[model samples]
Target: MKFLKILEKRKSIREYKSKKLSDSHFDLIDSLSNNLPNAVKNQGLEVNIFKDGSIISEKLDGIIGYHGIMIKAPHYLLIFGDENEVAYKMTGYLGEWLVLKLTKEDIGTCWIDVGANDRLIKEKLNLVSHKSVLGIIALGYPKSDARVSSIYAENDDKLISENRKGYPNTDIEYKDNIVSRRKPIEDIVFLSKWGNKITAEELDTRNYDEVFYYMRLAPSWTNRQPWKFILDGTKIILYIESSEQENNNYELIESGIAMLYFEVAMHGQGIPGYWNLEKLEDEKKYGAPDNYYYIGYYTF
Candidate 1:
């Protein structure tokens, strides 16, 4: 299967077989973990791989419903980042990339967040302070036909109508199932500025469709897809929409996941980009804030 297809087919697999990750697999994980692309070159993000059966078992203790499934895996990857601006966002992006890469290696992975304490895990790894544990990822061969959450498909006509109201002159392709839908290009791609819709004919022919295709497939909470991409020649800016409700950290996390998807899709296509802290003033005109966090920038 093609690389992008592997990404699309990947699911968060929880169950695992008894088989262990080979030396080569370990090497691949190590290389990818150690060599992850960072916004600041050679940043201090750290990843520790645990494979010893005893240590893995101990880590899984007291996590109800995940007792065996969590530790049964042959290996686990612990990702940590130093406390700083964009650290959590960067970790989220790179973490999701590792998950996708693991899928290509025919390994199953599930993201573990709840019930796992960074303090305890840090002591095990001898990691000092000034760094915070991000989360643990469980990886191994799957125990055939693992349970996966079902995706609901949106109605094409209805979605198109919604896009017509929100955007214009853009095209979108929908996969023939409840699992995939995309906003028309008009709804997203703007013409040199916000609210100025760009037509399909105005877009660059190289990789534009592919980038949008992969991004449209990215997972989001409640499928809100509150991300907007602005393309100016070699530069791409991401503008995030704030939630109407208060205390919406979950939405921010979901946006982080979307940012990861965009970065990976760009990398897989040989596009080089970097995350930045600078905010675009035009973004505020499009419903974003002047002082909101700038997720990243993509450069050709």
Candidate 2:
């Protein structure tokens, strides 16, 4: 439940206060970046968080982000790694973990959508790294008018689905509500197999109601929640829906974000587990469809 409070209050802050992040906050970020979770190292993904985002904000303004619109923030972090599927997923995992950690410190964070023009983007940003830019995240103290608890806040209870138990005592009532929309638990969680939907009672009986409830709150590309979970006995298989068209890199990143959210939610409930993304060869063996890409699984 430690992150539930943050998850409730966590919203993408596009418009930020002009003031830069404090020195202590900067140090905290440096520490976290250097001491990333072991999974990041194991995946061979390198995280390069460049401070002084003004230069990036200025240079790649019209090149990156949707509709060539970039968010101006005091700080920004970019993930660079080999051009691979799991690279994109782990990028999502690493970026979202930092976002949540920053959220815990009341530092606002927003993942800016990067276009598929990777080479052009690297050229515009004056990057030397041969790795692809998995994602970009803007960080800053949100403007008072733009703060979640102020003008743009959503009702906290509504964040965890209608009357969810994750944040039971939260009663943050704010005007100018920005409704937080999430797909229902049954919509994303499959029972025993892929596409085998489960009911609310089923989730409760399997002790997964809270995990899927809060996991649905994870941020995704254009709010497209592309990931799903299959509860296979003692294990949970993850799948991300792939578009028919090319450039489905963002979908893999969304898979990573969902993975992180599920892990955090499970960890909160005293369930410790890590995703075994090495099960790529088991996709056909598991009887998954072609459209749904197998990402990984968690065995507790």
Candidate 3:
């Protein structure tokens, strides 16, 4: 499917059919999950797939607001990151990648955080010492006419309009009712340094507009949209805001989810790029702190 169409059709599905997922569907998920990293370098992040709804229900009991209803789908993707071996940022990034891959396969997902009783889930999953249940994603086919929170839709629309107005045909692509939008290039995309806006003419690529268009629609936590992309010729450097203070891991995870969306869209459209981890020295020159977290890069 076209990347934009996937983004347009993708929505959080809490309600699902009781039918089992196809073997092909599970195979696709298994392949992606196997490739996903629990940590950047040799940190074994184990992703346990619970195909049985009964097991999911037994494990998810007492999770506030997340009854068996959400997990009643065909399966649950449990993402666990080893605290001693894996950085929280890596966990978030890789976990987000898995979710986006599922999205591309037409599977529905909603990321569940380890809240007050996260320990219960961790114990139920039999995670080893120094490992944590980073998040839970309920996966299955989305029911037609699934209802979404109006507030979520409204926030996403407002952010899209604010970020993606300058591109040609922006209005037609981002009508008021659409659920997502890209922040304008000026607002998010930077030059060699932060705070300096990279103009369309400055971008050497012919596909710059198309790339950013899909990026604006990438999802974020509470629509914080805390990702900054700096383009240097064939390279795109991803930087996450370092000072979320509380829920820093959660914020990084959210940014990772957005990055996966951007990368998938890029690859699906035949834009070749590879992700790397390199700190830009110019970040300090641009008034960004030295303490900023260097997530990774996507170089074409």
> How much does each candidate deviate from the true structure in C-alpha RMSD?
9.6, 7.9, 7.9
Mind giving the per-residue lDDT tens digits that candidate 3 earns over 106-142? 7766665554345777577565645667666767777
TM-score: which is higher, 1 or 3? 3
Residue 264 error, candidate 2, Å:
0.5
lDDT values, one for every candidate? 0.60, 0.74, 0.60
Residue pair clashes in candidate 2: none
- Candidate 1: list runs displaced more than 4 Å: 1-5, 38-41, 52-72, 114-117, 120-129, 149-188, 192-197, 204-207, 221-224, 232-234, 241-257, 264-273, 281-286, 289-293
Better-scoring candidate (TM-score), 2 or 3:
2
| Clash count, predicted structure 1 | 3
Candidate 2 per-residue lDDT, tens place, 165-212, comes to: 222233333224323466777888887777678999988876788888
Per lDDT, the best of the predicted structures is 2
Error of 3 at 138 (Å): 0.7
The CA root-mean-square deviation of candidate 1, after full C-alpha superposition on the true structure, stands at 9.6
Query: Which structure is stronger by lDDT: 2 or 3?
Result: 2
Candidate 3 lDDT (Cα, 0 to 1): 0.60
**What 10-residue stretch in candidate 1 is worst by lDDT?**
164-173
What would the per-residue lDDT of candidate 1 be over residues 1-300, giving only the tens digit for each residue?
555666576666555776888999999998987787655236577787888644654655444112223334567777676654465556556666777788888888766542335676566556686677765667888778554331111123434444222222223222345235556766766655666777666655556766666766665533566677777666677766666655343344445566766766777777877555455665444443443344655666
Deviation (Å) of 223 in candidate 3 = 2.1
